[model samples]
Target: MDFYGIDTAPIVGVEPTDLPVIDVNDSRMDFVFLLEDDSYLHIEFQTTFKISDLERFKLYDAALYDQKKRRIYTYVVYGADINEAEEFLDHGSIQYRAHAIYMKGYDGDVIFDRLAKKIHNRETLTDEEQLQLIFLPLMHTKKEREELATDVVELAHQIEDENQRFRLIGATVGIGDKFLADSYIKKCWRC
Candidate 1:
């Protein structure tokens, strides 16, 4: 999981197992990105509003400060609209940053109508966030005799060779997805 120059260990479960649970009243951080500069970024994926979000971030920051002796930047990426999340932190000591990602773009009628039908109809992970799951199908689906022949054709066009492409696409898709794989293929093509 490389972000910029930092190689982050892939975040697995959301549950905070090792970290001590301090009372923040509401906010909960999902993952942490620790950098070489001794600064850490705490990321929280929120789906709902919590009154104690800012306070919790402060508490979490202080706790991390006490343990790691490093600066912590608290951030939240909410799956829903930001209004509720914003209202909870009007004035607070913990300066927090928030971002919103639309989870229902393709699943909902709004953005889906804007794209070409073919783009929308392709087999995709139901949740856009579940893009990581695409690797499983790309690998096994091509090998399975039961899968639609058209999928194999599409995969062949997108990737060259059968056996080699199957393995390469499988490995890359798990970590980077088809977009990255396509980019790499294009770079090689240009060369």
Candidate 2:
């Protein structure tokens, strides 16, 4: 909801959620939710771009659809380093497409400062701001993502609310696990 304006109201359930397709594809896909509209939302995150990644998403979607017999919509959230990525794959008549969301447009520094001030003031963060804090490390910034991630973790730890602090730290670490260094994630867990 914070990122894409797509309304997936009344989520039925998490369809298979995130079980790695180890026996078959030997790969894992990220968030998947079954919407009330009887469709699936498959959210995948990537820090790098490759044409093959689209095919992997297609394969995952096909497997899910085959099992559930429902339509699936996939969205690939690319990190700031990836300015652009192939949004679709075309092989002869077979066409596979996934919505691409680039983090390059987001100014991480500006957002970080704003959130920091809010936390300093002890103001409760809105839902969107919370999501932004989790993904801030992946957004465009002059500093290295790993460096920004440490700052983000530090900022999250500063939150006065314990639950909010823990949620943000966990989410930031989960996303950072794919791109940020292990040390940054270790720092997050150390909190």
Q: TM-score per candidate, in order?
A: 0.40, 0.84
Model 1 pairs in collision: none
Stretches off by above 4 angstroms in model 2 are 2-16, 20-26
Error of 1 at 104 (Å): 7.1
Residues 71-138, candidate 2: write the lDDT tens digits: 88888888888977888788988889898888889999999999999999999999889989988987
Give the per-residue lDDT of model 1 (tens digit) for 1-191.
Answer: 22112234443323231356676444335556665555676755444556566556656766767877966555554432333355234455545444333222222222222222423455332332123222222221213311322232234234333454454334333223222345554543343
